[model samples]
Target: MNPIDTLNLDFRALSTFLAVLDEGSVSRAAVRLGVTQSAVSHTLERLRQALGDPLFVKSGRGIVPTRYALQAGPHVRQILDDLQSLSAGPPFSPATAEFTFTIAANDYQRDLLLPGLVKTLRREAPGISLQVIPSGIPSAEMLRKDACDLIVSPHAPEATDIMQRGLMADRNVVFYDPDYRKPPENLADFLKSDHISLVFGTGERPSFEISLNARGLTRRNVVTVSNFSGLPEFLRGTDMLATAPQLMSKHLLRDFAWVPLPFELKPFTLLMLWHRRNQNDPAHKWLRNQVNAVAAAMNKLNP
Candidate 1:
């Protein structure tokens, strides 16, 4: 297609094309675009003509993009995003802006960070809203796809497209019910006892287990639980001992007796992660700063 002809395509046509590609059906795209299916069809026709390609073809009750459309989708999305950013003015204005940000973090993070963040938001950017979700181990693909606005993970994923900033370093501690009698005197003895492990994506907990092995011990019989918040309850009145981040244990298991890990495991660094797409977004930058501030405050309180 001629460059001038491509320049003549309207934003509506590009938007329709993107919606169809995203939704895989005209009806669904119409619903997302808040228009009739016929309108979406008409817009698709326009896009097809402007691009000088069929763009998409019907396949098995749905539409599949032609190779040309497949190649164009990302470019179109990027262009649209750039245009939207240009029209929206600055990425952030503390005094007069409304933004809903979604973050993925674990229970420990919520306990340690949310209170300070809430206070900061109220004082600085009251118009912004936050939604916190439990984060798992870092996945670069998820970040790139914008599945999450921000991810607070124990360690940063090795992805060039993602930006990572260290938030805080937290120690890990071992905990058992206060009333329980048996306390392991050493790493070898600790290995003999049943263990309750908090597991996340791709078995990240084993890194800590390896530290134990290095000390001439390993967790033999283990029970895995999904959420860190539930570990205390699971350990209460049970013989199983659990290992968790010290900051989280201090906040959640205040009433429960806890002790340091029998073996020395390296302190885990909490980090903030975001996609390259938000690199220059003013609001995103502000939110990242708020998160870092919260982490810093928590570190001081704990230290």
Candidate 2:
């Protein structure tokens, strides 16, 4: 379409296009949009003339998006999301704000960063509350579906609409009970010893394990747990080694002794992730800033 034709397009037309695209029928879309079927037809006719695409085609007893409509869906959604953010109005005030922010995080991140964040929120925004859920190898859908407002994870799923910021970097370390076993002395010793590791709810192994596998190495996983909280209990009496992020030493794994890994593996960055739709929201921006500040403080103390 030419620029002049595009100028004729407006938010109402775009919104109607989305409604039809999502609901799959003009009647259904009209119902969802609280408009009559003729109104939807009129808007779609304008959209068709402007965009020069039929957008949707009849398929079986229902409607299906044409190639052009499928391609335009994400862009349309993004535009509408951006426009909605403009209505957020005024800066956020934490002191009097009373609302809860939900975050998705595994036990490791929940322990390492959130407690500090909670303390800060309590002091500065006492009226604000937080609810946290486990993030098992986070996916973009979690943010897209609004399952959580934020995610704290070492694994960031790749997607254009998802945004991430580095919280901290941590290296793999070996944790074991000093009374039950001595540290691995070499790569061979590490391989020979029985191991305990974390397997997320999705049955995906941790990045450290993936790195080891890439190098044609494997460990004898004598025990596997769903979350970091289960590690110490299994490692306490057994002569087993648990390789995990070094920063965990300050919290969850503190009761157990940890040492640098016997071999080198690149460090991984823990990240905070959110959907692009929330990018410009004033309250969300303030919450993100608080998370960053908490991570910064942790990095300074740990470093």
TM-score of each: 0.67, 0.78
Per-residue lDDT for 144-241 in model 2, tens only?
77889999998899875689999999998999999988888998999999999888889998877888899899889989898888998899888999
Best by lDDT: 2
Candidate 2 is scored at a TM of: 0.78
Worst 10 residues of 1 by lDDT: 1-10
- Cα RMSD (Å) between model 1 and the true structure? 7.0
lDDT digits (tens) for residues 1-303 of candidate 1: 563465446678777888788667899778766789999988777677766789989889877999999898879878876876777675468877787888878777777777788788888888978888767776765665566899887757775447889988888877777587467778776777888886665556646766765766667556787777777777788887887777766578775666787765778888889975586677888889989988887778777
Could you tally the backbone clashes for each prediction? 0, 0
- The local distance difference test score of model 2 is 0.87
Model 2 per-residue lDDT at 226 = 85
Clashing pairs in 2: none
